[model samples]
Target chain A: MSDHLPSTARKPGLTSSAPSVVAAELDPPTPRKRKAPGPRHEDKRVAILRTAAQLFADNGYEATSLDKIADQLGMHKATLYHYVSNKESILYQCLVLSFGNLDAVMSEMEDRSVPPLQRLRQFAHSLALAQNNVFGRCLVLVGSRPLDMMPGGEIRQFQRRLDETVRALIVEGIADGSIKPCHPGLVSSMLFGSLNWVPRWYQEGGKLSIEQVVDSFMDVLTSGIAAPRR
Target chain B: MSDHLPSTARKPGLTSSAPSVVAAELDPPTPRKRKAPGPRHEDKRVAILRTAAQLFADNGYEATSLDKIADQLGMHKATLYHYVSNKESILYQCLVLSFGNLDAVMSEMEDRSVPPLQRLRQFAHSLALAQNNVFGRCLVLVGSRPLDMMPGGEIRQFQRRLDETVRALIVEGIADGSIKPCHPGLVSSMLFGSLNWVPRWYQEGGKLSIEQVVDSFMDVLTSGIAAPRR
Candidate 1:
């Protein structure tokens, strides 16, 4: 997660090692032998998602078609359907992967041993770094707007959980006396706004490294820009 | 700006009293005495833009069409073209107006009479308020992705200018000893990320008013979320 890979190498997947629900769902059941999807099958699904995410990020989701993704992947459109149902499904999977990554960050935030402010900093750092990846870029840039008519409220639920995680961290910080008394909801929005906006302007080979960017954000978040009074 | 009206009343336009460049450019060259566009023409043009902006914000720029905008405005598609050449033109005009609003904030920030920190707060306040409007929602939500094929680089220029304005404010704040030492470029990005993300989650009549939102943002931005040192 620390190393921001180039476009081709940026195969964003669920942070956990287990096969994702997307991977499981994409694989059709065979009556003869109901076997777990092999590593190769999982790899292909991830690759399809990666390519689609890059295309979606480069071209608007509405503009990027399944045919384009297949062309990018050097696969037939039929073969592309073998991996995902449609463009929206690919987008849904990308978001699933993205929210999974955030869930991992939330787990870190839940570590009571660490100070709440420190955990919040870690959350910001991890989130900004995550945005450097293609899937994260898709989540931020392409967004869930294209998935408006898609069935299932999983995305909305994930979004609500993400918001709650940030708000919870702020509430904990306030209770622990590490953070100032502030509206958790408003502060959470500010934190997300700053972190989520990273992908819009952050470049791979830009002058400032992702670490530097995250550090600057942390400084602004913790100490703020106001000069110390005499 | 303080009054964030409902969708119908949210007719976002150029902040300046003078007729916008978009309005002038939209008008065709007449062979007869070339008089300035009348108030009725400007009103109709603004109405078209406002209606189109709402559609673009609601349905997205890609999904929206001239026909849909026309249907929304109760005008024929050909009549819609009378005011704007194409959907891209309408999008470009919306962006033009949104940036024009930001340019107004930039002008306010340029007032050296106010403290740099105060000016920075004003920038955040004005910017968040601007996001409550339909055009601002178009800029932040739909974005300039669909207009990638559109010829003019005006949007890019406006974006660059917006970045510079924010950076200049941070630099000024630092120079005046009002702001702590920091990377102006990175800080500007953080500031913009926070403000721009407002349109995504801000509701018209949500629990928090735009004023409360802006105020909370200013608080987090000025005073670090961290509790005071012993």
Candidate 2:
């Protein structure tokens, strides 16, 4: 979804009194064009996505339909189509955004100045917070099972890239002697498994903040539950 | 579904030629009766459940139907009703069995003479292995979302009991000084989250055995991945 409005149109001055007089002097007033796609358009699209993701997470993917989403959004079915093509497309976008959050965390890891252990902790904190969002919860609860036959295969690619990134981080940690020697693949599975399961039990305004949960998990993951050997 | 066949009917001797002569001497021969529900009936019921679980895990519970399960098992759809009332019943049974496995682990933990940390490790190992089974995978993948409104509320109760058991173990470990002091709730969530996620990535005949996977998880849980402080 592209918005081709001029960059000058986005300036706050255009909507204020002083800039309008200057524009009037510059050129004769003409019939105003229909409202262009702008911030409001993007906001509405995000609203539709958020509503759809919540429904999909609360009710399952198979049980949630576009009509229900439209009803929830108080938009006509036809009007809803202007924002999202279909239910599957909404789900696809939600997953894309969900994985995009993880991808951003991985991108931040490219700054090698941070030690692997700290980078891993930062990644865990970011991932836990991301998964607390509606789209992230939808990604975990509804999952890609419904989209197995969907054409793009982008979901699978995102999954593979995520797996590789986690494993690579663990390997780096091991190499730098920050992480204990272990099976990177298995350790990554445990890490992802623990973090991904967070959505199933995590409550937004519950007792613990996302930071606290991540901190507890990181503590357990680093120091472990067992008492130190005498 | 109960099988009320006589205990004598279960004896292997009754199926053997030598036992038939002893039975003839014991009583006069009469008209043969219809075959009773014995080992074969139990075997068939287990077969139906296993087939249904596989279908539910692979195709999803919403997408899977009793007819499809029958087709996969090469049995008439009506015949499936004899073993399970409907798809919901099959899912309930699968969850019952899955939770039953966890309950058994908790029961094993009742032996308090073993230190709490050792008991926690045993619980982790048992949980990971249970999740590797088809029924366990069904519980994780298909879930109770489909049967949420089912009348009995057994599933919810089972989940609560499981949460309490894990938390209790963590508390006990902390009291005994076998485990590091931490928030039992957060630690238990992390523990269950990690173990429950096994069904997602674990392949039965993949590179690692269930024991190996469990061992790795136990290692991570006990010692963690961070290298020891100098």
Indicate the residue-level lDDT of B69 in model 2: 93
Over B152-181, each residue of candidate 1 has an lDDT whose tens digit, in order, gives 555676678778877887788777677777
Clashes per model (N, Cα, C within 3 A): 0, 0
Docking class of 2: acceptable
Question: For this target, which candidate reaches the highest lDDT against the unseen true structure?
Answer: 1
For each prediction in turn, the share of the native Cα contacts (below 8 Å between chains A and B) that it retains comes to: 0.84, 0.71
In model 1, the clashing pairs are none
State residue B54's C-alpha deviation in candidate 2, in Å.
0.3
Off by over 4 Å in 2: A1-37, A224-230, B1-37, B224-230
At residue B185, give the lDDT of candidate 1. Answer: 86
Query: lDDT by residue for model 2 over B1-230, one digit each (tens)?
Result: 11222223222212212212222222223358755445555567767777888889888998898889999989999888876677776776666555434655677777889877677788877777666677778888887888876655566676676677778877887676667778888877877787888887777787898888878777877665233544
Estimate candidate 2's RMSD in Å.
10.5
